[model samples]
Target chain A: MKPKIAIVSASGCRACETTMLDIHYGVSALNRWAEIQFWPFVLGSSMADLERIDHLDVCFFSGAIATGSDRAMAEMLRKKCDRLVAVGACAAYGGMPGLKNLKKPATAEAADRGDLPEELALPEQENRVRALDGVDGIDRVDAVVPGCPAPVNLVWAAVSALVCGGEADARITYAAARLPEEMVRPILSGLGPPPGAVFAGEKAVCATCSRKKEEKRFKAVKRPYQAYESTGRCLLEQGLICQGIATREGCGGLCTGVGVPCRGCYGKPPATFDPGAKMVSAISSTFETEKPAEIQKIADDFVDMTGCFYRYTLPAQCMLMKG
Target chain B: MTDYEPKIIAFLCNWCSYVAADAAGVSRFQQAANVRVIRVFCSGMVDPSYVLKAFSSGADAVLVAGCHPGDCHYISGNMKALRRSFLLANLLKEMGVDEGRFRLEWIAASESPRYAEVINEMSESVRQLGPMH
Candidate 1:
């Protein structure tokens, strides 16, 4: 019998759906052993149809828990599916919507009331956003495939592995797929140490980043808007608040590889409890001043400290209040 | 309200602030009884997690006391601590933690009175702010 799979999209922008499509020919390969029982985006399956499904071999859930309905669906999937995979950064760690938590609650409320006109009043349901893990009883999620959109190949590898009765090693295989070639090549060639790191490499993003790290000393922090020549040196060393040192290295330095500073989309590295706080610690240690006033002045250069630090994982951060 | 005592966690560097705290006790200098001191080798060794954990674990405020700038036993450890404290203060504010809740002070081993003064001030300020959520 073919394995039955369900694809659930919650409060995301369908980026995960796009990632599914990006698999291209891999879909056909997956179709050989798995039957997509319900995929609302493509299969036109309704909630009633989802409820009718008695069992699902695997359920790939995408997006953050942003409403009462989203939480209900997540719970439903957990009950109905044997194996549930959180298939994106939103589902895993709250993603971009988490950034809204950085704003003061009063400020967010005022913006909601003041910005929208009477006819365009936002729905009450929109205010109930929460991270996937924030919802009670969500800890039972079996595995997580974390990324902004979740690299299509990694998802494909994970899904195929699950459908082939290799459920035990699916997560490990997905993590290996996310590892950088440079890190994996050593192990493959038997030259470097064994691979024991989860999802990303054991070290921070800087360990896999190609940038040259010279001794860094910065008098002032530079915003991305302020122009600076990219001399192929480390962006953090050049005064741009690149969070590579605090970020997990899964995206293979996709942003930093192109001169754009990493905003830590992949969340905190292993052993890090809070990504925002860790970034603050790393950036602070680089400031050139020991004088309190001068240090404050340099810190003032950061326009939005919380936004820069918790852009991707605010909902799951230690200091932020749970929704 | 007068009976409400704030619980403060003080992370003191062994070389400077911790020694100063001990000296203050030896001199019979009275400080706030609310503070619980944890000694580390350097102020830079205090990770932001430690401060956040203190707050989460019911600490009304956290004080990181270190060597004066240019006086770090490790040459630049206190300097690094100063920078971290600056960022942590702003982060705490952004998280809606009141300004007086997290503090960083430069206290040399010789300035035992300064340690007593800082603790007293922190205790007073946190008492005014009440307990953290």
Candidate 2:
């Protein structure tokens, strides 16, 4: 019997869902192994259909809880699904839009206003964007696949584990004759990463990079434009603020592999506090800035520390300053 | 504002600021009652998360105090603290955390009066700001 799978989005840009369309094995292959019950696109399913679904085996819920509608849909999906896989950075850690938390949320006075008609009222967005698990009704997410759009191989691994067991993978491999060994992870057998675990490797991105590393003696931070010496050495050693030191490993070090610094879209690394605070602590230890003027200079170079460090996680990390 | 008390979490280094706080207590100097101190081995050891967590928990304001430059028991620990303070300050500002809510000061072990003064000053400033939102 095929497992019933549903793929849904809360308030995402649809990139993660769009990326799902190219999972290498393709949608046709997915249909052969499991029943995709309620994907959000090209299907004739409506909210009524979603509400009517009895018990889905897995629901790949992408994006963050931004509005009242998004929150309700998240709760509904969680209740309807046996396992909720938080796919992409927004669902896992509250992605780019989470940065809005830095600004003051809407005023209580505005919420009290009753000028608009019932139909004219806005969708009622929440003060701060939240990840799936952070929603009040949802206590936890079974598995977390973190990335900008969520890397394909990791998603495939997670999908394979949840939908079918080893027997199916072997049969599919035999049938297709193109199952790569590295792609089918032995550990991600069923449900992939134990409950509430991240889908990617446990190591930080620095461990995966092929660049030469030396003892860090950071004198100053250089903006990406100011990075002069591009000799394939460690980006951090060159005075550029590469976040690979604190970002989770996966994506095959794609950003750093081509001289671009990691933006840490993969969310917080395992066994750590918030990555932004950790980065700050690490910077303090390595930085040799002495005088007040020098320290301030380094601070100025950061320009936007919140965006740089907490770009993808401010919603989870933001202290509630509003009602 | 006069009736309200601001909860200030002060991370005082065990070697310098904590010792100074003790001396201030023994000297019977008038000090603000609002500051609650957590003695750390070194100010540098106060991870940025600790301060951020303190703010989110209940602290209206947080103060991290260590030995003055060249006076740390652990050599360059104070220097690291100084560097971290700037980084933390910048981050707090970016997060829209009230400017006066986070502070860093250096008090030598001999400066008991300075310890009491710093505490009282921080308490008064926070009182004016009212309770943390």
Candidate 3:
């Protein structure tokens, strides 16, 4: 049976338009034997039509939650939908506007710099923008396709997988692809040392790509406490802020290759440890540099770059957020 | 007001900027030798970081010389260089570096000597601005 897929998004029409366009194009390419309905933007229809629709196998939630109405609608969708997929970074990690959540508590001095654009300007609002994970019951989100606007290829693959009853395979594969093969092999083997356990020495995480493989299973590896080494060695080893520790192995290690550091979109996977937290801890452990000023500068620089994708995973509770 | 030298790094594309610089040299234009020219296969081959690196490495000014925008030998290498320069210039200003330190100029092989004149003029302008931190 062709699973009926319905996509529900927030009030913003511009992003919703782009999302629908990508999904429409993706679906057309897959030529899947499935029927899909979109709420707004490209569908040229109303949400009232959604009630008439039934038996949806996959439900997609796209766009950011900006207004009270959006929150209400999203909650309603969560209850009504079977399998909810978060589309776009906004839905997954809270997009550019989500960065507004990290604003420091108001100080009279800092508040004086409030000459930002209308949407960003303040007398800042009291409640920070909520990530999708902040919403209750939305936690069981099955899949996430990220990009300020989710990439068409990823969205297509996710949807196609759902259509083929390959959601489990896709979920594991998603994390597997993001992770290095060495890590994946042990993970599949159900062995010890666990994910994010900090293997000693610079072990390439994947063999197919670059991870170093061990002949025998290694256990109880001690965390290597190396300081920041600038020779472009693996980020984990240098204690120089590498996302390889926390980010899923897939990406074929993309960002690190291109020179932009990993922003941690993979976030903390459900298993061993949060990758972001581990990397942060590693960086903090090497703070024996003795120069407070230099350490502060490095901290600030690391935050700006690494924090790009931090809000998605760093929970509202981490001290790193206070920093 | 005074004769000054421009410490400029000219990233010339093999097809055009290289030719233009050669033309400038062959013409015996008698321009300042302050400019250090680096030949690249394509202007697009130049990364924006290279421009930033040049500034940090103490070049008073960075000039990217390429074929006219649409005339790149690799089909838009010059365009890519142009876009990159536009972005790098804005970024440099944001980083508190003097905005005028980065420049992008299009030159053809036949206009090689014109390259030397440009170097002398650009160097003089930057010398007036003093060292960029």
Name the candidate that leads on TM-score.
2
Summarize candidate 3's per-residue lDDT along A1-323 as a digit string, tens digits.
67767767763334633654565345464346467664555566575776556546666677656455556656666666666777755666554545555553343334577644564434343244444655654656665655445544455445545554443354454353343345334434434223222111122222112423222211111123434233444544433344555454334555555433455553443342334334443343334332334444444444343243354443322222321
Give model 2's TM-score versus the native structure.
Answer: 0.91
**lDDT by residue (tens digit), candidate 3, B1-133:** 3654557888888999898877776777787777898999988787664665576566778888888856889987675555445334444554455766778788888776678777878887788787664
- Rank by DockQ, highest first: 1, 2, 3
* Weakest 10 consecutive residues of candidate 2 chain A by summed lDDT: A174-183
Residue A259 accuracy (lDDT) in model 3 = 38
Docking class of 1: medium
Taking all chains together, the TM-score of candidate 1 against the true structure is: 0.87
TM-scores, in order shown?
Answer: 0.87, 0.91, 0.47
Contacts from the true interface found in each model, as a fraction, amount to 0.71, 0.66, 0.00
Superposed model 2: Cα runs more than 4 Å off: A104-120, A167-192, A318-323
Q: Quote model 3's TM-score.
A: 0.47
Which residue ranges in model 3 land beyond 4 Å of their true spot? A11-25, A51-55, A104-126, A137-139, A146-154, A166-242, A272-276, A287-311, A314-323, B1-133
lDDT for each residue of candidate 1 in A1-323, tens digit (9 for 90 to 100): 99899888888787976787676365675676689999998889998998999999888888987666788888888888877877777877777776655554443476667864444343324453556766786666665666778887666655644565544344455565656555444434443322222234456778778888888787677766773756778888888889898887767777887888988767787688788778788788878877789999988777777777777677766554443
Computed on C-alphas against the true complex, the DockQ of each candidate is 0.72, 0.59, 0.01
